[model samples]
Target chain A: MSDRIRIVVLLFPAMLIIVVLFFGGLVVGLMRSFNYMPVIGLTEPNLQAYWSVFTDQEFFLSFLLTFHIAFTSTVISSVLAIGAALLLRRRFVGRALVNFLFQLNLTVPHLVGAIGILYLFSQSGSFARLAAEWGMIAGPADFPELIFDPYAIGIIIQYVWKEIPFIGLIVLANMQSIGEDYESVARSLGATRWQAFRYVLLPLLLPGVLSASVMVFAFTFGAYEIPALLGANFPAALPVLAYRKYTDVDLAARPEAMAMAIVIALLSAVMIVIYLRYSRRRIRD
Target chain B: MTHVSIQSLTKTYPGSSEPSLDNLSLEIASGELAALLGPSGCGKTTTMKMIAGLLEPTSGDVTFDGRSVLRDKPEHRGVVMVFQNYLLFPYMSVAENVGFGLKMRKVNKVEIDNRVNDMLALVKLPGLGKRKPSELSGGQQQRVALARALIVQPKVLLLDEPLSNLDAHLRFEMRDLIRSLQQEMGITTLFVTHDQEEAVVLADKVALILDGRMKQYDSPDVFYKRPVDKATARFFGGQNFLNGNATNGQFKTSFGVLDLPIDCRRGTGTLTFRPENICVTGKTTETNTINAQLVEKIYLGTQTRLKLAVGTEFIHAVVNPAEVENLEQGQRVNIAIPPESLWVLTS
Candidate 1:
């Protein structure tokens, strides 16, 4: 009994810190969104901040753009990660070097990757200079605008480049845990190499793929630095918009930014709940 | 029809000093069950994988019914395998797992259903078609694996230590189940196992392999009653070794000189006999009787095992409990060797 009591006492500080950092912050942000804050001299709670967040034209466009970039990048990255994992499952010369290069992106910051993309795809970038030297393009004006395009293609490409390695590492770990017996059995039952992969390996890898997609989605959705650096001028991503609103000259717009933050959190929570429900149904059946 | 024939099968892994399988040759007749019995790293599983086309042989030719199958893939070889862990697809229901092969082969839906149902019934898992493998017990999962393999109606079935993962009692039950199923289906089968008892019980003929070489291939009874070499003799529970000389039908050992019931070449060699053949009695009236002290007695319920020390050598014997009632530890007893029970092996 004394040992149990001592263990609880030891865990008390860490648990309290977690509750404050996670749930407490969420509650405070949500209350601010409802305009119920005494620190800023607002006593009566209201929904004015939420209405502003919902009615802002830039907010709606940026929110949609955020969804577009995150969904596109996550889907493309997951598919490519699965392909790379399958290809590298077997042994070959210099395999360790290739795996190391793929995992190297995890250590580099997203801002650095965005800067690299900008240097490579901008108007006076190396690609445009090379195309001009090759006589394919007359001048820098002929080069396609990849960076800061209205479609967020540059941000999507950057996110995919950074997130593919993370997804690949997770998938490779899961693939290693699956035993070789499943493949052997499928082959002996008259499945070709591709057939075995399609029927057996793919089904067993579904859970890992779904979870990795969720992680990639969450990471890409909340990302601020990459989008802030690469997004279009008029309509930025939700995180970029929130950061701008929070630092506005008029302190009255701060509540709207908090509301936007709460909305983003709610969206991610809803996505996670939906994913879990679907995965549970799949496992149950 | 000859289901499987291997001519000069060999395999060498990269970075390994020696080949795993070297110049091996085997043949499995149609409707016969054969076991490749050996210890770990003895190339039993390697040989099975090559036959299944999962591993490419370095230099060899595998034939099915006189046609070379080396160029064909695993799906075209008409063979199925059951692994030791019963690798049932966790995502698929039992029925879907069993029917997957048929569906892959482009069989019609109705035919696949009938065949799947038939296989499920055969494995005694008739109503378990809707449950996933994770929801079932180990034995049931193994049965589903068996059903999945057999549903394809392949030319041959390969079983790699299919019962090693079960408990002792379940192992026995599954052993009998597999044997009965094999006899019923009559599909040419090749089973790999390290357990000598399992091989002897389930195989019509056992091929004892060691170090990438075939030591002996014969029926279990013959392999036990008359082993060809010292290693084969020792592997089949032949525990007693007597330094003796054989002349026609008689062997002269330290205990006594006795005549065997059969004739052999006249030579100076060693004689081997099983422990069960050496009887122990209270009196020394029999021929070839040596008086020795009982070293240990182990009561095995049905039979009591006794150890006797004669000079510098110790001998083991199993006797009926009724005959060993008076036998006690450290008691003097007479060890009798019947003449016809002794077997002679050269070198």
Candidate 2:
């Protein structure tokens, strides 16, 4: 056999596996959402599952709640990560140690950090115990319920802790690529330090910021572990709601879970594509 | 227009054993284009950055037109710099990039437009306003950088190897462009370049530096003809160096003895001469000529370079293309060193 043919033959299995596992599953789920799955004994095509997904009150609330958490956490993390990356741009004593500590999140699972956050912020946790010991509060009962709050503050905090370092790593890589010449040139061109950063450095960093924010938002939207562990049960996020629907005793609820998964995937893909187009236009202009 | 004066400026980088610039003092008059010509690591860029206030001097001060700008910021000093890479903002359009400094100064809109248009025309990039830097070629980007700096009408213009990034042909064209622009604007310009030929072509006066020290500061002609030290002589295209005794306007060497002018009466010293100053002739004689065999010859388009073995040393001499008819490899020839062209450097 020729080398090109041999190479194609060697790649066939992996390609087939990816198509079967990813695209094939996606097509099957999408067809099932339209109620045209012969394997499940629903032959006539219909929009009943999608209509249920759209009209369900809890579905809309879960979608809005996911957006709120992801957008808020992504924006907050991007700003903090940019600040941290700028601070770490210059060499100082213990810089390596500080950088390692910031990147420690990538090694530790998010669920582990969420557990630690719960312990620290819970009503009967270390913070409450410390408050009682310091006489700032009378007892654990006086300590406010920070974890499992309806607003998902604990989840947002945990997400920021995990995501900011990831964004910082990206921002720092881009900043290092920019080097010191641009800043020095701006300074020589009669720009102050802050003005130089605002004019020259920030514009150059927009691409990295855009892509990193997209990744952070997508990860936060689909994140199941931290929100499942720390989020309030009253109004669950889409991921949590989907998990509940899948585990429920009713076999009919599984379609709605699959439909929710498809919606989340589509939303993330659209957001990424739109962000990429916007950033490309900005860079071109 | 502004006159720039430096008083013992010194810059010592952190953890470095030696200062990059050590107690250097120089002055550039208003509307004068001065070239800081040096080898790499000679503190040329450091000096330019210090003058632009991008770097703080370890000690001493810089003054512009009788005003000490040591404490003032770079914007307040009214100094602008054109970097080696041009550093044109990649995201902004050419017009926006050129007008950035003016906008920062809050110039009126109509006046900013007129000035930006005039600058673009001056750089010969009139209609390229809507294009980004990546869309422009290297030379065009350099022109935009030049326009960006000059549009503000800065008091002093600092250029750090602005033409080095260009190709040889573009470098020549941009050199001419920079010279004409500087002449038209009459702004005090300080250009830093390691290319000796570039320094001679674009500068009214050249400052030669080596190892963070100034070697010579003079007109290009004088710097080439009369160098004070061996380093300066070797830097300005003078190739041949001979160590011999000089006494009473005469010197004796292994090649032959040649008569020197009355001005160079040092007892013993080194003599330097350019390759172009040495001539080879078919006619051989005992006086004022050294009999040497041609080892190799290289044909450059306009001139043929001949390498001759004189004593134990090889000396390069340039001859006219037509003169090659009388010269061949392994031929014995008499090489003549004119007395006036010999430069004697003592110590």
Candidate 3:
């Protein structure tokens, strides 16, 4: 057999599964949102579901809250990752230990991480218990609701913790491949340490950092587990809102749920599009 | 005035026993260009880095105008190094790369632009400022690195094998360019290179180092004529070395007794001379003569090189190409070593 034909034959099954499971599901969800689902006895297609979901005040609040959490977490995580990467670029005594500790999250599930956050920062959790014992607060209620708050502070904190090492790994790889010449050359040219980092290494590291940030933003925007556990009821994140809508008892709400799901998917698609465009432009330059 | 002085500078890597650079001291006058010529891993670059305040010395101190600079950082030492790779920032344009040092000093934008332009013009890269480093040719990139190092007006300039990266033709061109630029700027400079011909051609003084130890330091003219040892002589393209016993103004060798210029004690020493100085003669009426057979002959256009065996000792010689055009291998010839061209070494 020809090499090209054999290679194509080997790759065909995986590609077929991915296309059916991912894009096929997206297409079916889009069609169902338009009221074309024969399984639910919906006969006619209309824009009623999209219009209703777009006009819903609760849905709008959820969308905005999701955006807020994603944006804040991504920015903070990316900056911290860049700092950590720079700090660890030079080998030190404890560098291996630090690297191993941070990368430990990569294998641990995000759901587990969110629950861990719940145990640490929830109203009656370890932090409040410690605070109460230390006389920092009178009781669990006085500890302030960090988790399940309207701000989604718990979700943002968890996202930042989980995504920093991901972005930091990418940034550190870029730093290593560039070696030490750029920074050394900068210092020799009368640049202070800060100036050398800002002028030389920062510009080189931006593309990696921004691309990693885009990945975190897209993932956090659609992820349901963290927001589901830590977010409040009314202004829940978009994925959580979509789940609640999808599980409603009234059958008429199926179309609205699917519409919201499509919108969440659309948000991730838009983020990915921006990442590709921005990275392509950088590559061309 | 001595612009820079390194006093007993030594560097030993953590895992190594012998020091990479051992008790090295040298002085460079203002506006003089000195070349630290050595083979790879001979501590030339280490010495330059120590002077630049990039690498800390194991023991001694470096000073500029009689003040110790060991306490100062590399940024404040007024020392600039143009690395061998010509590490131009790929993200920045040529003008920005040249203006980077000035920007670090917080010079105003207008002054930076003006100085950048002037320095670019000085390096013969005028009006090419808008282009990025990737767009420029290798020679142009080298010019940008030079312009960048010079724009800051450093007190001392260090060039680490600046021309070693260029092609042979560009090497000569950049060599001349470096000469003119160093003369015009009048900055005290230390250049590190392994190429002996480059050192002799470009430097006012050459310090030849070997195995992390300095063998000789003098003007290129003096080093070429009188190398301090056999290693230094061999480094500067020496091939013919004859060990002989010397007494008074004469030397006893396997072939014959030869006359000498320096006062020689009663002991044995090695005789060294350049290949081109050993001439071929039909008969030696002047006393220093030997019958040798030509083993190999290589005609290098202007000069014909030949290895001759005299009493089981091989001596390499270069002759005028026209005179030895018909000379063939395995032929017998008479070789002569004149008194003035011979230098005696103990080892």
DockQ of each: 0.69, 0.54, 0.78
| Candidate 3, A1-285: lDDT as tens digits | 999999999999999999999999988888879977787789789988999998999999999999899889988998899898888886678889998997889887888989999999998889989999999999877887889999999999899999999999999999999877787778888898888888888778877877888889888899998999888988889999888888999877888999999988888788667766875465334
Better of 1 and 2 by DockQ: 1
Clashing pairs in 3: none
Highest-DockQ candidate: 3
Give the alpha carbon lDDT tens digit for every residue of B1-347 in model 2: 88888788889987787999877778888999999999888899999888877788999789998788988887777888899889998888999889888877778989888888989999999999999899999999999999999988888998999889999999988999999999999999999999999999999888888888888888898786789888998888777788888877778666767788667757678887778877776565533567888999999899989889988878888878787766779988888877877778885
Provide the DockQ value for model 3: 0.78
- Model 2 chain B: weakest 10-residue lDDT segment is B281-290
> Highest lDDT, which number?
3
Q: How does candidate 3 fare on TM-score? A: 0.94
The candidate that achieves the highest TM-score relative to the unseen native structure: 3
For each prediction in turn, the share of the native Cα contacts (below 8 Å between chains A and B) that it retains comes to: 0.82, 0.66, 0.84
In Å, residue A25's CA in model 1 sits off its true spot by 2.9
A best-first ranking of the candidates according to their TM-score comes to 3, 2, 1
Candidate 2 local lDDT, residue B258: 78
Q: Lowest summed-lDDT stretch of 10 residues in model 3 chain B?
A: B258-267
Which 10 residues in a row give candidate 2 chain A its minimum summed lDDT? A276-285
Error of 2 at B123 (Å): 1.1
- The runs of at least 3 residues in candidate 1 whose Cα sits more than 4 Å from the true structure, single-residue gaps closed, are A37-42, A274-285, B108-110, B254-256, B261-268, B281-295, B309-312, B327-340
